[model samples]
Target: MEINILAFGIAKDIFGASKVTIQLSDAATIAELKASLEERYPKLKQLASYMVAVNNEYAESNLVITERDEVAIIPPVSGG
Candidate 1:
């Protein structure tokens, strides 16, 4: 399955684009997607932390992801 991901903040820089598409096995979990991303973009592993949102809501590691789902990467944010 091909998953389209929207990147924000540092995540966009790490991916070198605001949006990216990746291929994954059917019914892959958020954890799997994270691993795949870190593998493709090593800089992702250097982040303090990041979150995955599915369909506008934060998603858990075990949450199953489908091709039709709306996915986004929310990088760590620091504000004064």
Candidate 2:
């Protein structure tokens, strides 16, 4: 399955784009996707913290990601 991942904040800098395309197995989980991304983009593993959001909601490691799912990379943030 082909999943389009949206990048934000520092994630955009790491990916060098606002979005990226990743190919995964049909029943791939968020954990699997994170591993795949870390392998492809080592920078991702360096982030202080990050989370994967599926369909606009924070997803757990076991959350399944489908081809139609809206996945996004959300990095840590700080505000006054």
lDDT of 2: 0.94
Q: TM-score of model 2 relative to the true fold?
A: 0.95
Q: Candidate 1 — worst ten consecutive residues by lDDT sum?
A: 71-80
Q: What TM-score goes with each of the models?
A: 0.95, 0.95
lDDT for each residue of candidate 2 in 1-80, tens digit (9 for 90 to 100): 99999999999999999999999999999999999999999999899989999999999999988888899999997757
Q: Against the hidden true structure, what lDDT does model 1 obtain?
A: 0.96
Instruction: Look at candidate 2 and tell me the lDDT of residue 29.
Output: 98
Q: Output the lDDT of residue 20, model 2.
A: 98
What is the C-alpha lDDT profile of model 1 across 21-46, one tens digit per residue? 99999999999999999999999989
Error of 2 at 57 (Å): 0.6
Query: After TM-score superposition, what is the CA distance of residue 23 in candidate 2 from its true location, in Å?
Result: 0.8
